[model samples]
Target chain A: MAHHVRTDYGDSDPLFPSKAAVFWYAVLIAGLIAAPYLLESYYLSQLVFIMIYAIVGVALNILSGQAGQVSIGHAAFLAIGAYFTAVAQKYGLPLVLYLPLAGVFTGIAGYLVGLPALRLHGIYLAIATLAFAFIVEEIIARWESVTNGNEGLMLPPPSLFGLKLGTEGFYYLCLLVTVLVVLAAINIIRSSTGRSFMALRDSETAARSMGIDTARYKTTAFALSAGITGIAGALYAHKMSFISPEMFSLSVSIDFVMIIIIGGLVSLRGAVFGAIFMIMADPLLIILKDQLPLWADMVTHGLYLPDSVNQAVQAGVSRVVNAPGLKSLIFGIIIIVFIIYEPLGLDGRWQRVKAYFKQFPLARQRSARPPRMFLKSERR
Target chain B: MLDFTQQLISGVALGCVYGLIALGFVLIYKATEVVNFAQGEIMMLGAFMSVTFITTLGLNYWLSFLLCVIAMAILGAIMERLVLRPILGYPQFSIVMATIGLGLVIRALVGIIWGTDDLRIETPFTDGVFKIGALVIAWDALSIIVATILLCAALYAFFRFTRVGIAMQATSQNMLAAYYMGIPVKRMFSLIWSLSAMVACAAGILLAPITLIHANLGFLGIKAFPAAVLGGFGSIPGAVAGGITIGIVESLSGFYLPEGFKDVAAYVVLLAVLLWKPQGLFGLNAVKKV
Candidate 1:
């Protein structure tokens, strides 16, 4: 095996490893930009949703993946952001003013949540956030004076300056925001603050000993994560044109967590991949629901079983497929399977595949496998 | 004052149910160090199981309850073995997520099997109310409180006197140490899961009379978090105390406080408790060693 040698520090330090990488990214961006022209409005809207979810995944990755603070209630922050946008719009605030304000306000909320979080660790922190989420949901429902209570809030079409955004225009807006957010996330991860977060996540005591102000960084991570998620929420509010407390339920929070996990944690690209998967899973499931029963009948038709048995099998398949909870069941199964088998998520899998192709015939099977991890007991 | 007394009684009953569910959480957390987010779902399954045995199978009420508890115990053991055993030493976060997934799966399964409608479990004590001096207490409430006390006492004795119980205690204290001492740490984990599931089933059966049986009943497990945390996550007695306190606070708040406070009372208390004492009421704070 030959190792490629770098001639200078700049060669090794470049953001894009090679000209090919830069070209690929350029092509990817170009494809994204061209997507609206080729795709239907429905798919364009879905792309907007993907970008929004990607923003949230990135936000959560900053807090959870980088900082090692597990939050089971991030939807609360999203709720804050959406409601902020809704209320700000109600006051005739411009998009530019309210979008940043939504992030800032949600960041403030994150800071408040983080104060209590400073003391809590591991599962306790997760539960506190969970409790915080429940409280936020309740407040949204009961404080109808501003939130409009259970009736929910409706918004006028989001406008930039005085111009209202159509599907394509909004897509561009979301695309611009998504690109900025992703770039900002990458920069944060590369910067000293991001390094400190990693240090804190790896070992808070060690980080503290090394003069990293653990408290400040932890809170900062929370604020940054929540702020980005809030931005996503703002876009989400605009995209939907209506907001409700139910929209930001515990399930949505779980979905955000699922994105980072499925997309692969601790990587910006992973967040995007996870967002795509999360967004796509719903329609995929719907398609599967329709096709599964027919396929079941098809397979059983060839078997030449008795008519009664065939009918019974068909009925069972249809019932399971038609069940309202089928989506959750599939999601639940996927989450469990991923945790057990693919803990590194899709990004990890992608890395392995890339490594395999790079190595070609000489690629060792062991090199592609996830490294075995010992159980690190969290008894304390 | 009489009204207050009646509310208190019902609150205690409600708290006992919470305590029982929290006890399931504490038991699993104590032994396996894995917080079973699906414990409430287990309770829901238990309730649904009993409902099926009674309404579908036409079993006697007590007989169905017994069968349901037994079945849930077996299911819990199976779950621990199949799902949890592989990821025993993983990070708390992964385990938490897995359990949350398991919860979704269980709730969804229940929905598929039982349909999404609310279900009623016709218990022997469903109708009667105990009246004393203008105070009315439903028999179901009284049964819940009584059953909880009895269950706690039984659990106390089991932990104190039984060989398996002592082994479980040892294992919880130090798995490696217990293993070296010839305790079957793996079996103990299975047993703890089964025990926790049984407790959850009992709580579910008791709660079904009041809350009705629904796939979403597993959400009550969320409320049990405060109870478990308030008692400190690992302490059994603390779970009960924290649960009772939350229940009473919730009950009283619903009666006196403005609309919407009741729903959030448990969480408010939880946040306050977490802030005031992160170690919880009965929990011993362990200083981390580098």
Candidate 2:
């Protein structure tokens, strides 16, 4: 569509040839390397979580944004990875070997799920994936012998070469893996397979006409997506130091979806920004909940309001602000709002902001280009 | 033999409840091509509203049910006009995500208003049980079966005789053709949504007596999804048949098999159906034109 237009120089290239782009990368890498030492343990842990989510989001971007397949049951792959890692560790496998094993196993499972997905269309694929997630949860809960049922399984801290990896060590491990995943994702998107995926996503008929084996590419995309998500899951399990089927519920799957959408529809940069936004949103909501009442009091000062009216206002504000569901309610509302207003998500908005600066002298009332419609078939 | 018959009766009753919900799924999918993920939440809201009307407001059960159905219709209409109408031409995923967002909003709203308590509504036939030969059935289950038959007949007659109903049928088949023939297609969407919401409410009211009227009850919508898919995604009759089949299978498996087989049995049946006949038992297989 219109949004996919290449206005910037070297827009289609995988490598950043511009000095400015390389400089930004250097700054970002240096910041990441110094983050653990500069930030507190809690903030470092949050960064680790963001990195994990970014890895999964990038993988999902490959399948959904590039490949045109959507999955609402991605948490299943995460669950599989977590459980397989836990079980494999118990069987005396080292952390190094079991983690990759979890990825491979999850990839195989993803391939199998993709087989049925091959025949299914949009809504049907969504339903099947949803069902697959539920079935996986059921198995985890009931197969007590293997999954330890609803009681959940406790995981030991991972060790490499007989040295126990604590929170700081784990953060490094996660960061390293995330960087590798990002590199792989960039390379994959530049490959022929990635082109086939984009073609299928844009138009199945056109992709088929071009002699692309749509079925094989679709399944392969799923396998790769699940494999990366599985790696994230394994890292997540080690990071949390505790695991349960409850951890990978449907909401978790929905959270991954919000990541890609909020980050940006089809851009890798969008995935990173989306993950960072998703992780930071929780504390942001809490901060708002706490500050809204103070702000309300400040706004309504100097009025000798009746006690009953004051009480009512205060109680109502507190209820609205403090409800547990408010976080999710706001998230749900944001998803709808973004889909309607900003289909390009945070990345799209950022691009507009950059364009504004570039065209500052001649900027008009309707300066930013109208967002391209997300649907390819409906594109003008 | 007695146990088998008892399970069969109960399964039929549960199947009827599922069928009621499945009818709503089929209706929305037929008209909009978007599966309203918030359907279960809609059903749950109906039950909660009926409970408030009956207990908190001190109204008769029938009156409370009627008021709840009307409220649900309005809610459905409002949802369509406000949330769904804006992104009409977008891909199916957009609509589906919007409905999911709606479901989240509805669920949280219900939790805030009603509290998460497991409140039970008292129905007229709460303690009644009928014994016929070697089989015994609860009055709640029996009423559900009766309600299903009556509702199905009413829907059948509505489609066959009513002008709006016929227009809805035509709209589902081909929206452009119906518009050319002078049907108000957009209004038909609101009507279809209201009708679907009303059907979901009926299912909720029927089920409230048998289960706890809590926030988690919206999960039944997910269970009923397999039923709709089993019969065929598009066909009304298929949804009913699929619902009944899933209900019986779940009932029997829960009793005869291991502790948790009941939960996954519906999905297993669904996978089998998808593998063998993806269109469902009654759905027409669509041919792709390239």
Candidate 3:
């Protein structure tokens, strides 16, 4: 007990721990930069969509994950950013100039929402944001003078000093912006402000006791989060070349929340992971739906499958594949499953797997970390 | 004057239906401390079930209505036991998300089972109208009122007089104490869910003839949130009052305001109320434990 001990915790300090990690990370970045050249146009487009959603997902993570504030109306901000940029572009502002301006404009709107949100918490906050989203949608549809009403508005391809960017050029632009936003978010989450946010998330009273100004920080988080999402919206609108209120519905807001939850709540990296998962989810479901019948047929090949069984299987497969709300149904089930069983999400599972491999020689079969259990509220 | 009276009647009738749905929210929220986001979808499915039972299955209207209620109650019990019970101690946000997801799944399932197209369910009382002085109220509207009043009275009597009802109230008030007192707290929650679903089923049946059965009918649940909020989220009587208030407001606004204001009028009222008084008008201000 009295002997001198040498303890080393230096290995956990930085993101890139060793030279190998740095080199591999560099290689990854290089690959991303060169992706458009290697991949087909369709795949590249999917990547662009991923980057756009990733930006929104990261922004949402700041509010919901880091700050413990839930919003189901994030699409309203996206709509604002899209419409703001669209409107500005109509008045001759180039995409380059209007994009940042959209963020600022959306930030102001978020701040206004945050002001009222200060009075609310949890479920009340959620309902208020939802109502706000509905109101925004109504305004967008009814206020035809500005939004062009339900017919929606179209924009010219994004240009910089009269140079129009093609699909590949736009992909690089989205990639570059997403990278910058990611870097900025990492920086923000590491700063004192970020810690304060986490503190507020864990316990408002405790954070207050620590002399953190909960009110100012909460609204600032909202402003910053909304601003980033606004930028994503601007990118989305430009990418689509057309925008409508219908595109950003309550479901989109729910999708953002799902992204953070599935990505691993309270982790920056999880945001990106979630974006990739979300972007690819619909296609994955389609593939699954298509394959189910093939699998079923294979299983029943050696046996005498009745006409009724065949008809039933066909009907079920068609429902899965072609049902109008199949995507939503799948998304809902995923949310429920993830929240109940795998609350730590994919990112959490990834960490555990990594730890298991790293500790392989001396590792015990059982995980040291206990599964997250439901925390009954202590309040009487 | 006649137009005004007529709007008032329709508004009252609509508000009662909303109140009925709002009551579902109140009941579940009171017992479980979780809002059933699928309340509207439950209503939509109930309407679809009744329509199928009557039109497709060739059952009498009354029998179909009764069967639909039973089915919905069973559905509610299954949902509470299977889906919601596992994550009882999770944060409120996760539970809310689960409910939202549940709503989506239910809506989608309803669409797959019953085609996406809207279907009219004709009831015995759809063709008639009653003239009371200057007001020419449709029989359907009057029936909605009658059904809602009967439901409210039944709920009140059940809560006040029945042992099971008192046990449910006790459970909501203090789960631990109720558990200690030999009450099955979990069973109470299951019963509350079923009861709430049954009321919503009744609302759906009454609402079917007027609105027609459609998947989009679930959106009515969203509007009813304001009614629940306006009434004080926890109080059943407050829910009814809030529903009436919202109904009157929506009716009057639709008549007087610019088009589209009617859809969002309840939210405006709700926001104003939340801003001024965080606790709903009838909701008791819960003291925070420091």
Candidate 4:
């Protein structure tokens, strides 16, 4: 009932100094260590947020990518985790105890939600989960009894073994937690449970006929997915030092999908890649918003655009030019383009590029075969 | 008693907008097998266009309304052709994501163009209020009821008597079979999409007089989704019934029950309906070929 764990390590040579692998590892490792030092604390904080999202996104990949389920209301589970941590911390629960308790709270909620998911598959299950997301969000927004409604509750600083952890400590906590989560996810996918999830994904009918407890496995997958995602939410709230319903909106749920899709949904490396890319985009786009107009003037007026079209093009430049909304428009277009051209997502393309380099000499000897296999694999 | 009647009437009127939007949801779902979550955003954008027609372009409310419906219809056609058609053979999950993404893009664009502030829709028909037997009823609630009944009747007539409507229904029923039978299924989808957007715009126009026109007005569309589900996803009549039921139930619940529960009443009904009968109130039962 297990998946081919060797799928990940199939092409990965342990001995050979593959040029692309070395370059990617070197870049990623250096960037990860250097990021906190190179960027301002505010930017580092943004990166921390991105990493938290990456953790949730990767966690969700288990249910979505591996289990073949579409969940649009992931933020509800996120809120449960965040609010659990916030409440526990508020009521004087110790950090170590509260964190695990937060995970348990969300895990049970996920399991409960997944119960209905047993009967419904695909789109219907997605909508039910989405509805649940809405329910939770509204409760958080309106339930003044516990949640503090729209205003949200404040969280006290986390303490462990008599040390008050500040923002820097929280950032490091998020980073360490995310790395550990990614490593755990990678290991899980290599384990039997991960294979069963994939088996469910490939064909639930086959998986069922093969004596897999389809209902139990599906629900368990969701619970497991929620466990990791909820922890990410807890970490996110702890980092922000506050918990609000607005933080876990429908849009935030979509952002997780964007990260997973762009990162190549099925890859373990995608968790890190997605975090760094999205983290960079977080600040880079803000800088580019101003620089784009200037850069446009410089590049278009001085260099690329024809004299006739340049003025017209500059005039039609949209209303939300200053806000992050324009970047959103571009991001939407990029996603559409990505879905159409590179549906395997960025990691899929990265794999192709890696394979091209890794197998350059031998594959160059028979280049036509690789391209054919590529076209076939990408058809879905 | 007056408060009760006023709330009931107003709730029913607002429910009609949900019904109309739900109608579009059912139509699109029937034709393309896609539950467009972006339909509300489409309605919001339509309202903005209608506002632009009346306020900016200096037209009468009736003329502006008709013109905006046509414009919305055209936009819908373009969307069906440009955005949706390209992704036709892809999985339903991706299609849902794509439309949700499109909704975001549209919402952002609308916000940028119209600013975040709410706009007043000065429909002259909404200028008066009347009282009946100790009940105060606004012109808005009355107009919405009349407009919706008229629209539903007209839609029924169009679908029943028209060739394109029958072809559309046939296409929705069996795409490959309809194609084999010489039906223009592709054109039918475009027509359905345009008609769907037109219906959503109708709701927007109806909704605008009662409420302010803004980016946030689209939130009603989310509420209407449960209405569609509570009815059959495939049944036109069921959509209307579902909307009215939700509206009345929500109004009553908000009045009698605890506060936040009203927000979830539609879903409560949905969950109940799903548990009892998943195909919805009017949906045809399907026996899957194992």
Please tell me which predicted candidate would have the highest lDDT against the true structure.
1
Off by over 4 Å in 1: A1-14
Global lDDT of each model? 0.91, 0.87, 0.87, 0.78
Q: Kindly list the per-residue Cα lDDT of model 3 for residues A306-372, writing each as its tens digit.
A: 8788778777777766788888888889988988877777788777777778787666656646455
* TM-score of candidate 3 chain B vs. the reference: 0.98
Q: For candidate 3, list the clashing residue pairs, or say none.
A: none
Error of 2 at B248 (Å): 1.1
lDDT of 1 by residue, B20-65 (tens): 9999999999888899999999999999998899888889989888
Interface RMSD of each: 1.2, 3.9, 2.0, 5.9
TM-score quality measure for candidate 2 = 0.95
User: Candidate 1: what's its TM-score on chain B?
Assistant: 0.98
Better of 3 and 4 by TM-score: 3
lDDT string, candidate 3, B172-279, tens digits: 787778889999988888999999999999999999988889989999999998899888788999998899889989999999899999989988888888888767
Error of 1 at B222 (Å): 0.5
Error of 4 at A169 (Å): 3.7
- Measured with C-alpha atoms, the lDDT of residue B11 in candidate 2 is 89
Model 2 lDDT at residue B263: 86
Any idea how many clashes model 2 has? 0
Query: What residue runs in model 2 are displaced by over 4 Å at the alpha carbon?
Result: A1-12, A299-304, A363-380
Q: Count the backbone clashes (under 3 Å) in each candidate.
A: 2, 0, 0, 1
